[model samples]
Each structure stands twice: as C-alpha cells, then as structure tokens.
Target chain A: MLVHAGNSRGAMRGERLCPAEVKRGLLDGNPWQADPSLANLSGVADALAGNGPAHRIIIDATASGEVADYHAHWLEQGIHVVTACKLGSGTTLERWRAINDAVARGNARYGDSATVGAGLPLLRNIRDLQAGGDTIHSIAGVLSGSLAWLFNHYDGQQPFSQLVLQAKDAGYTEPDPREDLSGDDVRRKILILARAAGVPLASDEVAVDSLLELAADGASADAGLEALDAPMAERFEAASAAGAQLGFIARLQDGRARVGLERLDATHPLAGGAGTDNRVAIWSDRYCDQPLVIQGPGAGAGVTAAGLLDDALRIARSTPD
Target chain B: MLVHAGNSRGAMRGERLCPAEVKRGLLDGNPWQADPSLANLSGVADALAGNGPAHRIIIDATASGEVADYHAHWLEQGIHVVTACKLGSGTTLERWRAINDAVARGNARYGDSATVGAGLPLLRNIRDLQAGGDTIHSIAGVLSGSLAWLFNHYDGQQPFSQLVLQAKDAGYTEPDPREDLSGDDVRRKILILARAAGVPLASDEVAVDSLLELAADGASADAGLEALDAPMAERFEAASAAGAQLGFIARLQDGRARVGLERLDATHPLAGGAGTDNRVAIWSDRYCDQPLVIQGPGAGAGVTAAGLLDDALRIARSTPD
Candidate 1:
C-alpha cells in the first residue's frame, strides 16, 4: 500500500492515491494535492518513520538537491532510500560520505543503481568487486546515451547541428540540448562510478571537454548551429582516416576522472556499442588483462522505473521482518 | 573465521587451516587430512550447523552432483550455500524447485552467480529484471568461453580441431575438450537462465547441436583430428560469404532453450565480443527495440573465486546479526 507521495512543491497522504489520477493530473499540468499535515519534509519523514517490523523505503526520483538533503536524515531514521537522483553521491565527496555513513549508523540500504547507466549493473558490479577484495585499476565508458547516439549517427556527411536537432526531436536529448552537450551528466556518472570504486573524486576534479563548446551561442534556438558543422566534420574525417570512431569517453584512473571526445579504434571496448547504448569497461586486479564490459540502453523512463523497482525489491528481500 | 573445509573425499575443522598448507598439499597431490568425525556429509553438516548467532555458510566449489544433493538440507538448516557448482540449479526442474523451496523455508540464500558466465552479471541481471516485473522475451548469448575463443580464432585456414586443442592448452577448455564441444555446458547455462526468468524448463527440453558431432571419432586423440577440417572450413566459408561470424550461441525463447552454432551478423548484439568474452543479449518488455547486453570474460578461476566471495559477502551483509 502507498504510504505517502510527495514532490518539491508539496506532500500528501497516499491512502486514496491511484495511478490514473496521478497520470491525469500530470497530463493536465497539475499534480499532488497539498496536505498541510504532511506538507513539509519532516512531516513526510515522520509519516514514513520505520517503527514496525515491515521495511520502509523512500524512493527519490527527483533531481532536486533539497530532496537529496533529506536522504541522510531519512536513512538515519532507519528508512531505506532508493534514489535515481545523482545529487546524493554524485555531488561533493562529503555528501557521498554522509549518505554512506547514515547507512552504517542506521543499518539502512542506499540503492543508487538508477543513478548510473540506468541500472545496467555497473554500480553493483563495481561494489561487488570491491567487496570481494578486488582493487579497481580503471573504469572507462561511453556514459551518455544522447552523446552515444549523436556520435553513432554523425558520419560527417550530414551537418552535426542537424544531427543534434534530430536527436533532440527524437527524444534522445533534453529540450535544452546544451544540457546533454555540456557533458556534465557524463561527469556525474563518472564521479559516481569512481566513488563506487573507492576513489573519492570530487565533482570539479573531472576535467570536462564539453561538446557544447564546439557550438556557438544560440545553437539551441536554431541560429549559430552551423558553427559546429566544420569542426565536427574535420574531427570525423580525421578519425575516419585513422580507421577510428569518435566517441564521447569518460575515464577514471589513478583517482582522476576526465570526460571528452576521443578517437577510438573499432576494436576498442567502448567503441563497439550501437545506437544509444552505454558501454563501460572495468579494469580491476582480477580482470586485469581484459576488462569486464557492460553495455545496454543507458537511459529510458521504463528501464529507470524498473531499476528503481529492482532496488526496492532488493532492499525488501534483504531486510529482515 | 574459517569454520570448516571439505572436499569430495572428506572434511575437517578449519581451526588450523591455512592457504599455504592447502597449496602445499595440492602440489604434493594430497589435499585434505580426512578427519573421521567430519568425513561424511552428515558429519560435515553437523560441523557446519548454525547453532550460534553467527551466520553459517557452505562453499561448494566442486562439479559433483552428489554434493549438490545436500544443498536443500543445508539451506533448510539455516546454512547459506555459496556455490560455483552448476549441478544445483542447472540440473533438473525438481532439484531447482527443491532448492528454492528450501531457501524460502529456511530463509537462506543460494549464491549461484559463479554457475554461469563465470563471475559476470548475466544471471543477476536476468533475476533483477524479473524481480522488477519485466517480462523476458528472449535471452541469447555466447555463453561458453571455450567455444567463444575457438570461433573467434577459427578462420577457414585453421582446422577447428587444432583450435580446440589450442583452447585446451590455453586453459580455455576443459582437459577433455569434448566436454566443451558437446554444448552441454551451454545447455545447462541456458536452463539456469530460463529458470531464473521464471521459465520452469526441464533439462531435456533444450536441444543442443553439439560441435563434437562434426568431428569424426578419435578427434581428440590426434589420429582423426583432421576429419573435422573439411566440414568446419565449409561452414566458416559459408558464414564469411554471408558476411556473418559463427558463434556458439545459447538462446532461451518462448519457454524453450536451445544451444548450437549459429551464424550472426556483424551488427548482432552477441557478435561484438572479443577474446573469450561472454556476450549476452537480454530482450524483455522494457528492452524491446534493443536488448540489454552484458559482456565480459566468461571463465577464469580468479573470477569464479571472486564471484563466490562476492556472494558470500552479500549473504553476510544481508543476514541479520
């Protein structure tokens, strides 16, 4: 049964909630009735406080830092937090430590599988390897689905600007395509992976060579789009001449992270994925010679929802009644 | 702390056990000290019985069906079983059901990640998808490391038999190369995966087209090794002509499992792996247009050991103190 549902705007009891009502409200551009008794974060937390034998879980699906602030508090209250938000562990190293510390202090689980690779087992594998006493040497990946699609289809024959617009139209990118082109999403993912692999990499430590810099200002508004065409065409031609593909790569090694566009050989692990696939190669003490690779649809609403549900199920199974 | 150690021959207390002694004994071709009190299954069970607050775990590293028979009993007695053995869940439907029943009855976990894809996350992903309420439409993969290695190197110029021998020498295949060529290992893996996806498929239901049949008798003995040359060369040529690569693929679809050699296009999800990598494509309701793919080193002692340790750590963490 639904205990409570809330968003940044307000909170409410979920006793009489139904998916149809929620969907209708979302379609009508209005959602969630404000209940004063449960309107604040503390009220919601109090409603979700775990005092019974049954496990209590709070799912964080927002990108709000305000909601992320409640993660440690809720976890410390013995409430499990399954989050899709990157703000928890992908922000400052201090916040990452706080979430983990809260888990230890309250014996609660923090399921952040949906934070990276859309729950493709990347984080789980890294954590499992570390738990098994394997030292992670490096991790490299094509972490951004929008960038993957962009590079996969950018053959230099078509203008790169046209391709970006096409990708945006196809729902492969955000409405503000600059958000994807900025490479910050990839930076967050790499940070999450690095921290998971025992490296406390701060957000600013990752040197990002964003694709957005290639486009002139007002590129998203259909003007100045041609600025990206010549440079991108040149890079594609150079990569083709060397029998390589251009990929937006995120790398973490020696406790450092970098995200940028790179020319990778066809045989490279990160260069083998198709369409919007997020392919990652993990190098560790055990898997030293050939890195362990995982690839799949990196971003989608259905898969993300499935991932959150998977995390919840895992917590439910692990928690003792 | 080490509680007990055992093998097919006998078992002993782990109080004074050390890796050095085990290594020396193995080098000397004499492994265990055969204590009579812990010699048999029941004696070993009694020694490992969960009497205290501490969690009890049994690690099964053997390929013995005899040892697999005790999984239910040990689990029913509140002892966790972390196994690399395929005989437990990859066997008959009845045995698989019995193990699950015992897990539910005693609230014990059966860690079988090492059973398929060595230490890769194939089984875990399939399980997580199912747990998240996603319907698995199909799962296809190059599940055998030995076969993957063989096909990856088997140009029409090289004799398939020579490739098999090379794989054996490289430790990619079992000492008896026929075991790898027979396709039975892939069959067992497909069965395990199918069952994990909620398909209660029997062992006999999988139709395996063994590569061993291509070789005339005595192929492993060098006397008739060249007998496989013509057929394999012809098949390889046909696949090349069709712009496809030959892969020993295991597939589970429509509640059925099949293991055989199939010609896959360059763009096929399972066709992109390198050097003994186990590449798998999982098709489900959520991942319909494009399957979720996972690739990694499919077989290695270190990875298998790591998988077992990972499982043990999971159980230890999950168990309430």
Candidate 2:
C-alpha cells in the first residue's frame, strides 16, 4: 500500500468518487486521497462517488484550516476527517460548527490534532487535565525556539549576523531560518497553547517583538534567511556581553494572555538555556496544592517525527482505517 | 429534566432511566453517572444510551487500579475514558494499544487528560501540535512547586518538616505537599510529558529520588510535614546570607528520566527563584545551533485554575466528549 509517488505532492482529494481510484488509493495507503484537495473544492466534491474502503480521512494541510472548509461534502461520505490546522482552533468555530452539524448529519469525526503546529502539545494536555477537574492557575513557558536563538546572539549590537550564523551552526535556524526568527513563529505557537488553555483569543492579542531585525526591503518567504542575516548583527552585540540571552515566553492568567520577549541576564533563570527549547507550564489547581508544572524541549526532527508516528499509530490502533 | 432524587448512594442504584430522568441528566450536563442502584455494567450502560446529547464524565477512583477495571467496561461503550490506573500517558506501548483499540472500536476518542493528576496539561499541547511536523528536542524542568519551595527554605541540617510548612505559607506546597516532596508526583508528570513528546516509556523506568528526610517515625505524607518545619527555618535563615535557593528539576533525555533535588547557590542561574516559581527547558535538534529554554511561575492556584479553565474551554470547543 505504500505508493512511491515521488515526493512532489502528497494530497488527499475530497471523496471524488472513483471506486477504481479509491481501490488503488486504499491499496496504495495514500490516506491523503480521502481528504479534500486544496485546489478546486468543487472538483473534489464531484469526484466522490460512494463509500470506499477509506473510512477515515486525515487532512495534513500546510495550514490546518484548509481542510476545514469541506465539511459539507465530507459529511455525506461518513468519513471522519482529522486536521492539523496551524490557526487557532477557535478561529473557525463556524467551520467546526459545520463539523458538529456534519456529525449530527451522520458524517465523520472532525479533529484538529495539529492546530498549534509542533513543540509543546498544549491542547492535548489541557484536555487531559480538565477530565480531572484540576484547577489551572497559570500557563507560562518559552513559546518560540527560533526567537530564543535569534535573541541569544543579541549582545545589543553583534549585527545579529554572528548570532544568526551561530543559530544556523547550532541548527536552531531552519533551512529558511527567518521564519523561526520572526516573532510570528512563536506568536502562533503560544496562541495555539492559549486556545487549548481555554483562553478565548486572537493571534493579535499576544504581543510579539521580532527576534531578527526586519529587512527594510520586506521580502517574503522566498527571501528565506538572507534578509534576516544581512541586517541586525551590528545592533545586537551590546546585550550579549552583559550576559543577556533571548527567550520568548507566553503567559496566561485570569482572563488575560501575554507574551514575554526579553533579555535574560546571567542571573535570569532562562539565561543558561542551551538551544531551541520551548516550555509550557500549567499552574494546576486540584491535586494537593500549589500549581503543577510540565516542561520540556520544544522542537526537533526526532521528536516531531515521533509525534507524527505517534499520531499514525494512534490512528492505526484506533479505527483500523 | 433535572432529576431531584435524594443525593445518597442508594439513590444511584434506584435511579430510573425514564424520559424525565434523561432530561435532568441532560440539563445538568454532568459527564459521570455513578451509584449502586444498577444490577450490573448493563445498568450503567443503559443509563448512558441516550442519543446525541453531549455530556461530561468524571470517574474518581478510591484507590489504585480500581478505576481501570471499571473503565475497561466503559471502553466497550462510546465513552472516552480518562484514568490514573493506566497512570501517566507514557505507561507502555501495550497499554497504549488497548486504549487506542477501545477508542477506535467504541468509535470514540481517548486521552488520559489528567494523567499527571494536578500537573498542567501536557498531552493536549503535543496533540494540538501534530500538524506541521514541529519537533521536541529536549525536556527538562523544575517539576515540583512544593519541592522547589521546600528546597528554597533548606540551608543547614533542615528537617523536611519545616521546609514543607514554609512552602505551604509561601503558597508552594499544596494542602498536603508530601506527594511532591516524595517524588512520585513529579515522576508521573515527567512520564506524561515524555509520552506526549512521543516517547514510549513507563514510570518505573524513571529513576526517582525523594528529597524528604525521614522523620522520628517515618516520612509519611501527613506527619512528615510537621517534623519538617523546624530545620527548614534555620536552613532558610542560614542560606539567606549565601544567596542560594532550592529547586527540584525533572529531566527526560535519550529515553531516560531523572530528577535533581538541589540547593543552587548564588551565582547559579536558578538561585533565588522566589516562592513557587519554576523554570523548565529543552534542547532541540531542529534548532541544532542552540538549546531552547522556558521559565516561569511554576506554582499557585490562580495559574493552575487558569490551566484548568483552558482545558475545559478546549473541550467545549473541540471533541472532548
């Protein structure tokens, strides 16, 4: 069932009913085929013919929200759809409503296992604690690994070059590391965490100060890390000597959410942090007393690959689809 | 539909499953249905037969392993069971298989949301981040607020009793903080985090070292605290000059987990972490250039309560029924 489709794109088109195709798909274990295609939503709808061997359809979208729009066509097929949208889970309550309606209409299960996109598994953790009626006093941690690394080199004016290079050397930066340096990366992550924490929020609500100096020219994703590096090294050196390390943090309290982007001096608790680690802690209520905390590494190939493997195993062990 | 039966143990068994009773249960929206009025598991099963009305179920066990046996029955139904008997999420792959099977066969979802008991949400965050292939590189943190608190107070030949009391006053210890000081609580939480990060582990595999000193009789959960109070004061009085602090750290790496119970001196980054504050960090491979770090207030009702509320809201917003 493992089809080597040659790496360009692995997609799940909406139940574009092609019994023969489905047979091939299921046989190929191209589970993505059961999902709606990104292009031409109507085309995918028209293709779905009838119930095929695929009962579960998981849409692993570039942005988890993409698959959310196809609840209608998916419901009639009775094929459950699980998504890992990058946006906050609540952003599309309207779409989720469609899902709830689809469930009511005898469709399939709809879940967003990947809404927050990697690192600390915030949503899942909150759900587990809630089952026990545990009180949560606060949730605090480093939400962005990229920003932390970017700031690590900021000695007020190291030109941010040496830092970016160091981050690159350390593998903290991505092939395109700017995304990691930009405040956007951690901001979205913490938003996902906050949403799971049950904090009603919009991404804008969390303040973000970029870890990398912005390019005046304003290049897009295509610019990659080039724009990020060429600038800022000159301005970041001063902060590094006094022993200030960069770390991005997200915090939640009574009806409020805040992001902490600061320089941690040698005395600061986080100053000694090594690289690209993110932590989310919940001040838990209910057990004996004082809040309970959970902390850990926030990013990497091994962990993420294992996480997906866990999801795949979970799916395999679940419905047998 | 709110059933106004007498709130007694006997009433649980005698409870009728009439339309009125169903209405009451629906109106209350409680997730658990417990009492002695039923003949067998079928009675509990029958009570749960209503269609489409969303609800919450909380199963609180009196002791170890009691809840798991009962839950195996619930697993046959569509209930998404969360329990402590399975303990932390990282119990075993074999256990994970059973739970996953139940979730699949029951056409349900299963998560040990409260696996770490009072600790903050761990699995939820990992689950939510499953979409974009974000990875977890390393996990290390000060897991026990109470232990951290106790460590803060100890300077000399501090009996654990005085320190526990000091933690209690500082809002670091719970009503009974012995669970934390004993190391079991922190170990369980670390297991949960490890599993969420996709490690297949068991709590027994973790090496735990208790920081509690043996009292006149023994270091029990209750009496131990009383004996602990005296030396703690002197420890704090003595340490204040040296500018040191006590902290409890839980770490998971290379499939192994351990804890550090220490008195960090002045010059140590973790020194002087006041009150219930906790700091956690991770070293990730994705950001190979640097290790990521996260730190924050690791204890308190306000923070924990917020975490609980977050879990409740995530459930309300998603598929936690």
Candidate 3:
C-alpha cells in the first residue's frame, strides 16, 4: 500500500507516486528530492501519520538533523524507525537522549544498525555485550570506508594526491573530498560507537586530529589534492620505516573519543583491510583478554540498502502484523 | 516470588527456597534430589504448572535429554525457557527440531545464548547474521574455555598432564577430565553454532577428532591423566618446533562440522587467550574479507552464572512482567 510519496526536486506527490512509480523513482539518484526541504520531509511524516498505527519509516536520507527531529516525533507517535543516518544518533548527547526517551515513551524500536558499520552489527553487538553484563572499556577501529581504502592503498607507492583523486573518482569520497578529509565523518562514527558502548557523548567533545589543515584556504579539489601529497608522503614513509601501517583510527575509551591517523603495527586489530573495509575491536570486561573484532565492508549503496532492509525486517518480525 | 526449588540429592520440597538458600544449595552441587530421575523431573514440572498460566523455566541442569524433553513440554504450555544446557539446543537434529517446533507452537522464547561459548554471544551473532541476509561461509574457533586454557598454557615447558590436573583442580574441566579431552563438548558446541548458522546438523553427524582415544577404557582419573602425558608431550614439542600453537579447534564449513586439535599461529583469531577464554571467527558475505572475531573467557562458574542471569533477564524483559 503506497501511503504517500513526495520528491523535493521534481513534482511528484500523492496520486502520481504509486508503488510502481516510487520504485522506479528510487532506482536512480534523488532527482525528486535534490533539496530536501522541511516541507517535503514533513510531508513524508504527515503521509505516514495518516496511515494510522503500526507504521515503520525507513530513513535512508543523510540529513541527520531533520531526520532525527522527525524520528523523535514519529517514535512519540508509536511509529518505528530504521535509519542509515548517523546524524540522528551521533549529533548531540541531548538529541540522542531525546530519541531514546521518545522511543521508550511510545514503546517504539529505533533501528540504527546501518548507522555505523553499514550492514555490520557493530552497534547491536555493543548493545548485546552491555546487556550481557560486559563493561566495554574501549572501542578502536578504522571506521570510514573511503578513508580506509585511501590509507590502505596509499603506502607512498604512488603520489597520495593521485590516490585521493582516484578515491574521489571511484565514488569512495564525498564529492567535496574535503568533507571526508576533515575527519568529521570519522568523529561522528566514533561518537556513535561510543554511545552504543553506553557513553553519551556530544559531537564537539570528540578530539579529532584532522588532515584537512594541510589544504590551503579556498583551495580547489585539485589544489587540495596536490597540497596533501608532501605531508602524507612523509607520514606514510615514516610509518613504513617503523614497520607500521598508517590507519585513520577512531578510539573511544575512558569516557573520551578520539579520531586521527595513527601508525599501526601488523599485530594491531585495526591494521588490516583490503578496500573500504571497516574493522572494529571492542575490549570489554567479558572479552578483556582478546577483544571481540568485527570487520567488513563498512560502506557502499548495496550494503547500506541491505542494512536498512535488515532493520526493517527485524522490526517487522518483532512487530505484530 | 519463590516458585519451587529441588535438588536430586535430598528431600527438600514443598517449601519454597529463598535466593540465598538456593545459592548455598548450588554451592554443594545438585542435591535437592541427587539423581534427576524422570519422575522427579516430572514432579518439578508439575509443581511449576500449579503456579499459573505464564511461567518461565530456568534449566541450569546438564541433563540434556531430560531437560530438552521438558523444555518442549513447558514451551508447549506457553511457558518460556531460559537455559544454560547445550543438550537442549545441541542434541540430535530430530530432537532439536522438535524443541524448536515446541517453541514456535507455544510462541515461547528459548534462551540459548549461554549454551555455546559460555557467556559469549556466538549463537546470537550467527542468528543475527542470518537474519540480516548475510550468508555464513564458514565458522572456525577455539570454543572450549578449559581446553583453551590448557593449550594456551601448555608450551612443553612443563608436563601437559600436570596442566590438565591443574585445570581440573581449578574447576575448569568436567569432573571426568576425560569429558574435556574427549572433544564431545566442543562437538556439541560446533553443532549448536552450525545450527544457529541455519544448518540442521545431528549430534553424531559431526566428525569429531577425539583425544580420548589415548586413554584406555575404564581408566581411573589418575591413570588417564598419566596415560595422556607421553602423547601430549610429543604433540606440544612438535607444535613448538613448527612455530605454531596447539589449539583444540571446532570448524563448521561446507556443511560439515569438525572438532579436533590443530596448530595455529599468533595471527589466528583463536590463538590468544590467557585462561579459559573462548575465541570465535565468523566469515560471512557481509564480513567476507576478514572474519568477525569474538574472543572472551569461555567458561567459569561466575561467568556461567552471569550468562544464565543475562539470558533470564533478556527473557524477563521481553516477556510480560
């Protein structure tokens, strides 16, 4: 049953967006929702609300701020939420607490399985560990798929600039590339993971050692890419000489979160990944000696879709038909 | 809310035992009635049935055949089950299927989290992976905490039999130490894991490579411990010379479950464990590149108690108060 469909870009709404039309529309980019205005997003919520009770909303949009606001509202209305957006869960400690409180108040489930590790069960694992009476001491990982791919391949073999350009061309990095290089995404992921481990952390609280400072002000993508070569080359060269690999690592420990590039030895848990793989090692009271590690492709459209569906199916199975 | 309590050893019935009393009783072993005979087991069930419609049974007994039989009956009565017994989940495929059918028919939850990997989330992880549409290619690990401790400590520096004796003394192994060496527990665990991964495997169907063959039939504990020295010495020496550590590994792959001794390097997921720690690595499509690895203390009285409570609390939270 198609309840309601609205696209921000093109004029498609109500009668025009049947099940078939919506399916075809989602096949490509968000032509209908290029600029997801507040009216368009609220239109989605209003349509879902009109459908009565027991409705589930799958938020695949990355606008965490707007999506989280709607998520809180919908959850308060006893509607379930499954999201791939980290911003909803990763924005601020206050918002995080609000979402949780809303879900509790309405007895709704908020599925954030795809928010951190794509389709991997990193958040769920952390939650289960906590439920099992395991005190999670720390979590460290290479979280960003784009950053992991770039670092894993950028061993001073070729100019680091070329790899950054190649990664951008491969659709691995954000279009601006600066967004990924800024370390904000990794910081958000670390905070998300930290929250899952029972740590309520605000966005600005995380200490992010970014590589974006190397890029000069008002530099274009090409200029920024070229400027990063010298510094990155030195970092990679030093790491190799020390028998260590350079990894963009995120660590949450002792009530603090840190994200930065680190020199990891071969034996380190986060030291291995082929391409765009996110590997996390969680050290806890129960898993104290050898941390529980989960590694896999952390990003990509296919995996994100799988994660969203997985969360939806989970809610469906648990919710009464 | 003291419902009922009984030990197979003595006549302590009709009066409900308090939490402290039950703790004291468990300290000495199962003695409320010594032998968990069929009639006594049935009587316990009957007493619980008299309580009310919605009842949850926590079976901490090791009597696989009997507990599973009763688990089916209780579940059919709409009574939930939280258990630390592997037999209920690890028995023959037919019995396993029967229990599952009972759970489904009664719409009752079966808590099997503590059955394998002691308190670790091995079974749950496998189930979640399957539910998330990820195909598990294979699973391999050091599942037995007693064996993990034994192998981890035994480096040919001291007599292997002495380490076995120490492990037994520390309450790490089954009373008959032969049970640990027999690989039956590991086989059951592998079968439990394989079933959780969507493979309906019979208990006997597993190709378990046993170490018990070294001990003569009807040998005493001392005699068996003595007989194990020479073969174990040779094995450890060989493993050391080859620069590999010996691990009692359980593997389920290509629709086959195997349990036996194998050599593992430091890089192996199951290689590192201080004392009675169980480590597992799961390979699936989502986690295809590098296996999802979980490591922790696999066995201990305190840890097992924690697992049972954890499972019970999970069931309690899910079920209506």
Candidate 4:
C-alpha cells in the first residue's frame, strides 16, 4: 500500500515554479540556455516566462550518445535528473556505483524505476542483496519470454525457422523477433546485472558465445525478423535428444565476463522454472551460505507494462530531492 | 566504483560509535534517568568526566511516553533536547528542518530514526505520490513479520501452544507474542501509516478488529495461545481458496483509522506475497485509475538493519549544510 505516500510534506517535494521567480532564477547569472543540448529546454524556459518553475522534465531522444550533453547541462543548472539512456549494450535496468556517483556529484536526486529493474526484481536485489550477505557469482536469466518459449519447444528437432514462425504468430516474439533470438539482448541484460554486482564491465565487453545463426546478423531492428520461417527443429534434434535444452547463461568469474549458450537439463534451475517464467540465479560469496535465486515473469507486454508502471510508481514514491 | 565519492561525506556514515562513546552518551546528564520508567543512568553519569559544553540530549519516547520528562530534566541542566514533547515527529528526521528547529528551540538536535519513516520510504513515497495527482485511500500491510506469520500459520493447525514460543521461533514477537497478535502491533503500524498519509490520527483512535478467540481469554500468554489457535487457518484457507491471500491490513479512510486482518485477492494487490515480505498498498483518490503498491522486506534483522545503515549512509553522503 505504499505506492506513493500522500504528500504530507507537499511544500518540500517538487519545486513550485513561480514564473516571476523562475525568470529571475534564469537571469540570475545561470546561463543554461547557451548550451545547445538545452535548446529543447525552450519549453521549460517558455513555461517559466510567467511566475513559475518547472517541477520535472522528460526527454526520450530518438538516438543514443546524448547522455553527456544532458548530464552536463543539468549539472550546471543544479538539477535533479531521472533519465534512461539506452542499456549501454549491458544491463537493462540497474544502478551501479556510477549512478550513486552521479547523485553525489550533481548534488541532485535520482530514482529511475523505469530504465532498470522494472517491477521484475532486478534493481532491488542489487540494492539490498548485501543485507542477505548474498554475493552474485553468476546470473542466468530468461529475459526474453519469446525466446524462452521458442527454444523450449524447438529443441533443435524442429526447424527453428518454423518454430520461430509459429512463435511470431502466437505473439510470443516481438513484431521483429530477432532481438529475442539473437542473444544480444540477453547479453545486454547480463551486462546491466554485472555492473549492479559491482563488476566493472560493459555489455560489449562480455564475450558472447551465441547459439544463433551467424547469418542472422544481416537483419535490422524491424525487417530481418521474418527470416525464422525456415526449417529449425531438424537443426537441433540430436542435441535435444541428449537431454540438452538451449539456455543462455551469463557468468562472471575472476574478473572475466562470459555468456554461455549451453544445454541445461531439467536439474538446472533455468530448466526447472515452470512455464515461460524468467528465472535468475545470483551466485555471490555473501548470500546466506548459498546462491540467491529470483524468478518471475520475464516477458509479456502486460508484464512489461506493469514493470514500467512499477518504475513509475517507484518514481512516484521517492523523494525527488 | 561508487564508493569513494569523497571522505567529506563518509565520515558521517559511521554511526557505529565505540563503547566509550555509548557509555559517555548514556552518562552525560543521565537522559534515561530523567524518564519515569527508564532504569537509573548514574553508572554512565559517574563515568563521564566533566566534558565540553553540556552534551545535547535527545530522548525519543514515542513508545515510552516519557517525552515531557526527558526534555524537562535535560533543559534544566542547560543540556538541550529536541523531543516529541515539543517538536513534531517529522522535524526529528527532516535534517534541515530538524536542525533549524533545534537551533530555534535552543535544544540539541534530538532524534532517533525509529519514530519517523525510519529509512524515509514513507517520506519518499509521500513525496512521489503527491507529485503525480495522488491521494491515499487505504494502507494495508504486514507491518510486523512475526505477527503476520503467527496469524497466517501459527494457530492450532501448527500451534506450538504459545505466542511467545511462536514469535521467538519467528523472531521479535516480543516477550509475549500475544501482544503482537492481539492487533496492537498492527494498530501502531496503522497509526504510522495514517500519519504518513497526513491524516490526523492517534493510535487509540484506530478502529482495529482483533480476531483472537474471545472465548479463549488469557490466563497466561502460552495457555491462552493454544486455545486460540484452532479456527485461525480455516479463516485464512477459505480466503485463499476464494482467490485471496491473508494480510494484516491497516487502513486510513476519510481521516478515521482502523486495521483488520484482510483476505485480499489478486485484485487487492496484497496477495501472492509469500512470506515475511512487507507491502504497502495505497488506493488513492489521486491516482484514480489504480492503486499504488510498494513492497519490500519490511521488517527484519537484515532489512531494517540496512534501513538504519541507509540512514547513516544518507547522513554521510549529504552536505553538512
């Protein structure tokens, strides 16, 4: 019941812009408008023309590489930010020390419940895992539900092509399902996770030994996904018969980062998870003398929507300052 | 990587005082001695050699009801205190506000994190919920794990024949777990929730419906517990079968307060939680579309300990002002 606490202390929460005051603040030697990145801030500036201040701002750039400009402008303006730059080819939704550093350096506040750790239990685990004395040695996840379902029944006996086509029709895969099958998304998620565990590594830095076809690289975000209509089960029948199920594993050891495309049996935590649910195993030195396992819905538009809302709720509930 | 932002802030995070400091604080002006029910504090008093300006004494008597005496005794000795007796509750944790009030009242900054939102999730939520047109309807949660597990699983079905025994097995039920299960713990929790929601509420005014077996009126903590245990499960199981889960719910409705044991289904959002996980569900008038949920390890040796440490960390991380 603690989504957002009622504003018992409303006056202290967000800035109540008095147009006169904001204009004054703007002219009071804070030359933020000169920054090219803030050209979009014209909306905020125009809004401040009257006696007012902007309580918050949101920007979703169509591209990447804009984080530096955004952070610099805000830092100079002494602003609080909650931005979700892309996954950086690593983790999806997580806060490593880099975030904490940003919070400190800017003398600003941040709560990005959206970008990382939607409602699915990623960020909170990282934020509070130490409480359980749990350290994460490995994190194996079924991040893409479509992939999990496709690979589960495919077993390489069926042409992955037909199975992927079936998955597309079932709405299990994204409209462009390539992201779900290529293992790149999984690698990015692993990177986000490693950073959360205090492992200093980038998503691209992790060596990914993928099980997907190398020819799939020719596909774009939207177009190439239809390539899965070919025969696929015939490709993996023998491996499937060997009690091997395709599972993507992200592992960290002795400062080396790696992603494994392996066959996990039913005994594996990944294989044992019921349904298309996402299961994650965190191996750490600190967890109560064993590994910490967190499992839940890994996919579904509804679940992702809920996760976004969860982030919204988290943002809604935290003190902006 | 986020660790050494700077020593400028880290020094404040060291809430872990040496034994000498603890002894010194206890003896300085005998803060506890001034409280009516508190044991004498002379042992500490005798140990402190005359020190610098009389120490600032802060006594938190939210539970003990000793606020008035705490301030009076310390104030008379030219030692200062900021207490619930004089300043309001939020002022105790609102660092800037607390310091301002302490200086204004000519008292030492007196506070313990226990009384307020503890780790400020309440305050943070309050800040967030208010920002996005949100009003709280009800707050229901298992504020205490011991009481929740006791009520959920402890009755005759698994009765050990005693509340204390059950709680001890669960941790922190009290010298008498009966007090916890009897609705008082949830009542206090409701009061806090109400206060967080900005409702003017008092603990006694909370409308609590206790489910203990009325016929099994206590002769002793253990004896009455066995008599009380039998019917509890059918009540919970029936709720679960009907697509609901059990939770000790604290509700704030229209400025009045009350708490009850709830058999809430998935619609209630408090369902599906397994064990010892604490949740706050706020159905607000503001966010009319849906209720907001904030779930976490609410009460625990580890979670709360992390919370306390987070408080210490916040202090260490903030500017000294």
- Considering every candidate listed, which one attains the maximal DockQ? 1
Enumerate the chain B TM-scores of all models: 0.93, 0.64, 0.88, 0.64
Query: Highest lDDT, which number?
Result: 1
Per-residue lDDT over B140-246 for candidate 2, one digit per residue giving the tens place of the 0 to 100 score? 66766666555645555655665566667666655666666678778767776777677767667888866565344575666666665664555456556667554
| lDDT leaderboard ranking | 1, 3, 2, 4
When summed lDDT is taken over every stretch of 10 residues in candidate 4 chain A, the lowest stretch is A3-12
Cα lDDT for residue A315, candidate 1: 92
Per-residue lDDT of candidate 1, residues B100-158 (tens digit): 99987857889999999887878887877787888999999999988998888998887
TM-score-better candidate, 3 vs 4: 3
Off by over 4 Å in 2: A1-51, A56-119, A126-143, A153-158, A166-182, A186-245, A248-273, A281-302, A305-321, B1-119, B122-145, B153-162, B168-321
Q: Write the per-residue lDDT of candidate 1 for residues A1-321, one digit (tens) a residue.
A: 456776655555664467665555434446444444455776766665555337888889888888888888888888899999998999888888899899878578999999998878889888878888899999999998899999989989999989999999999998888788889999999999999898898899999998767764646545656677888899999999999999999999888999999999867877776788898999999888788888888988887887898899899987787
Tens digit of per-residue lDDT, candidate 2, span A1-321: 211111123333432445567556545657656432434444444333445444444434344344456654575566555444444243444543455577667545544444443424455556566655654566766656565545544554444555666777778766666666666666666665666566656666776656444565766654534565554443334446655555566667775666655556654434444345454555655533333443334455554544444454445445545
lDDT of 4 by residue, A1-321 (tens): 111111111111123435444334344423431232333432332322333333333322112443424443453343444434334224422334444565667554453433432234465556555443445566656655566666656654455666767888888775766666667766766666676677778556778765455445566443344344332333355446876666556666666677755667643545533335455655554322223444444654444444444444454345342
**B177: Cα error in model 4, Å:** 1.4
Query: What CAPRI-style quality would you assign to candidate 1?
Result: medium
The count of residue-pair clashes in candidate 3 stands at 9
> Distance from true position, residue B94, model 2, in Å?
17
lDDT of each: 0.84, 0.52, 0.76, 0.48
Sort candidate 4 into its docking category: incorrect
